[model samples]
Target: MSLPRQSISPLRQRMLEDMTLRKLSDKTQSAYVRAVRGFAGYLRRPPDTASAEDLRRYQLHLVETGVSPMSVNAAITGLKFFFEVTVERADALAKMSPVRVPHRLPVVLSREEVARLIECAGNDKYRAALSVAYGAGLRTSEVVGLKIGDIDSQRMVLRVDQGKGHRDRFAMLSPVLLQTLRVWWRTAHAQGKLLDGGWLFPGMNRVNPLTPRQLNRAIHAAAQAAGIDKRVSMHTLRHSFATHLLEQKVDIRVIQVLLGHKKLETTALYAQVATEILRQVISPLEGLPPG
Candidate 1:
């Protein structure tokens, strides 16, 4: 009998296995795959066939197409990983360089806006989800990936597992957040859901958790319903959480731990966007009399 042909290309399979071995996040793995596919599409050949010149030309093409430097940089990083790590082609990656990202403060909603937005969620389930997002500063993935076991009612803490960089941490479980979660949990359980240590916010099929797209849409709808337009997303709740806490005189270190930021400077960025801090400042211009 003839040997069977593999459905997946050998290169692609190996790349995936390499990423899995390194324990790269699925998001990062997908980005790397997409970057490799884009490269292949550009050259009309397999990514393995890309030479250093081809990589340079692709970088030029990206910039010429008016792609943001940050996006271009991310694509370059992905391509670097796919070629250097997956394809064992370090020389090909040398010609590809990342663009510098300009520093910008994160967008943050005021405390009142956060409250109104959460209140405007169309239903209890969405409302509770959004509340947890803001109340605990959990990322969209973290919020949707929550398991029932992650909630420590007795300890008054929320367990966040495998957050950014695959790190685990704990967030405070405020009485209000705990109450809202209990309500949603009771309803879900009464309806014969929450099966087999299922996702706290199960998706339609009830096997997978709610997708990020759905969570993003809910946030957008809530922002619109609340009549607040600030380019908000699920992550905006996280920004608001940190900013609001900073405004409340919470320590930057505490906020850093809560947001699961690896660097204190990352948490310190919120200070730049905290309006309360700005409001308390007396400008030197105030010294100019009646200008």
Candidate 2:
């Protein structure tokens, strides 16, 4: 007996193709597709049959189920795009109200804690990665995507190409980090590895290089070894870098440029986390006798 032929759904296939054709980053494509797929699963049917009422029910379900406000907001955005852009059902999704979330302060690490984490790295790979992260204030993705050519030793600057927002900029390259990178390069060369391609810290895949997840895992392991009690991640390194620099009296505008933030307000948020500023503040009740 002949087996029945499997078929691909037009909607899903179209979504995949659209994602590819737009040249969206793999991470973003995965997130967008997952959010939309979650909506489909919630409806218990194809997304085409979902109405604004269905979407509202899903939103309520998310809140009652204790989903993060960010996740819930992302789901709504995904469904709205699907309905409006792909399905041509704009007005229905547009009428839905958005959930509001209060802005919370970001977690930051102290410079001493950052030093311990880097020092506790078990291997050269993790050490090198964290060194660049803290030394140059690089995002995890930026660190992984670094190329040998990006480091201009003569100028003492690391050229970050197509960072966060697809914009190019330069960051200070510390002398210590450069020396360590030289050692890494020699070790990589001796192994007959280190291809002359895009990435500096290439993954075992070699061609594609290491992922942000792998970097995160390395950081997590190092944090455990260092005995850090604070919740830490790859981004925590970035936060620490920024807050530490601000505490050291570096200009906030300089940090904004280094972090590639489009808005000054975004960089100003570090003020709350800068310990040095808090230390200098005067209390109204200081020098008073006990009541």
Candidate 3:
């Protein structure tokens, strides 16, 4: 007699185990799960039973249905990982392809614009949070994940734990930012939010850290108040930080370490947006004597 089968498929269980073994981030794991679920829902059956033709057809359907290329690519990546790594059927999914996304320069706010944005934060907590984003070039998640103890006042360094790729790095803390944090800390401490060590910027529920959505909304509202036209977000602050540093003549290699970029090329992109650097360079036209 055959051994009893479980309600959950062995294939899916193994896929989850594979992801966990690889130590993927929680966000990445969630995205993979959602992508696989979408595939299964599209097929109206178990994803394990998908044939090569079925995969191609589903991909075509996604494009025909006007799904964004980035999203389509994410779904494809999930399926590829599930089949190639988890199910060990790499040959069957060999035809899978990723969408080629166009490269675009990141948005960089002017120093004045960044100042206005921070000034419009309304409250000291948000002001300090915005300052950290621009001052340290941190991601939204990283900014929200900050703990009170991460600030090293004496050494003037902020310890970032489990950043992207699960790597730890120290970001520079400016004198101005230190003062801002001190004020924010004083307020939080008085409110009993930081009686013990906790989130530097707590959410409505002080037990947990502030949510990304709320932080994003605060940034948006501040931008609106500042009367800036270009679309800006927490990421824009990071981009501006890199570009501003490049403008200041800071080496690209150093920026790479601060941003935790795996590749130097990734950090070099900021050179294109370093407006001040472009301005200061002697134009070849200026070098030429009157023609």
Candidate 4:
């Protein structure tokens, strides 16, 4: 017997087309679809039929259910797109507003902790991957998306194609990191796990690139093995990278460029967590004369 076929709803199809026309990334398209689907699940009807009051109530429900402010804001943006762009019913979003996300400092690991974490990774592949995340200050997605050709040993840079915001940029390729990658490449090549100009970090099958989820799991395992108590993720390495650079007296603008951040203020946030920089500061009280 043949399995039954699942069909896409016309509404969803239309939304997908709209997203594609706007050149939204696949990740973003998926998030928008999920947001609309969640709203439909709550409404018990088609999202297109949602009214202004219904939208308000749905947001209230999300808040009452303890959804994070960032997630709630994401949901709001998705719903706004659905109504304003897909269904042409912008009026329905009149009462809906995005929640204010609280600003929190990013968690960073000490240099020693980072060393221990990398050493504890399960295998060479993960160890090298984690090193790239810290050494080059790349996001997890950028690390996994790397290909053999993206590395420019001659130029001493790594080409990041289509990073966040769908923009292409180059990241630093430290001599140390280049060596780590070369070692990993030689090992994987000897095992016939690498293809010509293929993914730098391939999955078990060697066909697909290593996914963010897999990398995340590896970092968690490595952190546990290293006896690190602070909450750690792939981004933690990135935060540490920027913070360490700031502590070493690198210009904030330079760090901003290296991190591919658009705003200087966004990169300035690292100043708040750079303990070494803070230690170097002379307190105002210290400059004051004794009474």
Candidate of highest TM-score: 4
Can you write out model 1's per-residue Cα lDDT over 136-247, one digit (the tens) per residue?
A: 9999999998988899999999999988888899988899999999998898888876776778888877888889999999999999999997899999999999999999
Candidate 2 wrongly placed segments (more than 4 Å):
1-8, 20-23, 287-291
Cα error, residue 188 of model 3, in Å, equals: 1.1
Tens-digit lDDT track of model 2 for 148-240 = 799899999999988887789998888999987887777876775588755678888667777899999888998999999888998888888
> Which candidate ranks first by lDDT, i.e. highest?
4
Q: Which pairs in model 1 have colliding backbones?
A: none
- Model 3 per-residue lDDT tens digits across residues 141-247: 89999999999999998999898888899998999999999999999888887636789999988899999899899999999999998989999999999999999
TM-score of each: 0.93, 0.90, 0.93, 0.97
Residue 135 in candidate 4, Cα distance off native in Å: 0.4
Worst 10 residues of 3 by lDDT: 1-10
Task: Give the lDDT ranking, best first.
Answer: 4, 3, 1, 2
Which portions of model 3 miss their true places by more than 4 Å?
1-11, 288-291
Model 1, residue 71: displacement in angstroms? 2.4
Residue 133 in model 1: lDDT: 92
RMSD of each: 3.3, 3.9, 3.9, 2.5
After TM-score superposition, the amount by which residue 30's alpha carbon in candidate 4 deviates from its true location, in angstroms, is 0.8
Whichever of 1 and 2 has more lDDT, that candidate is 1
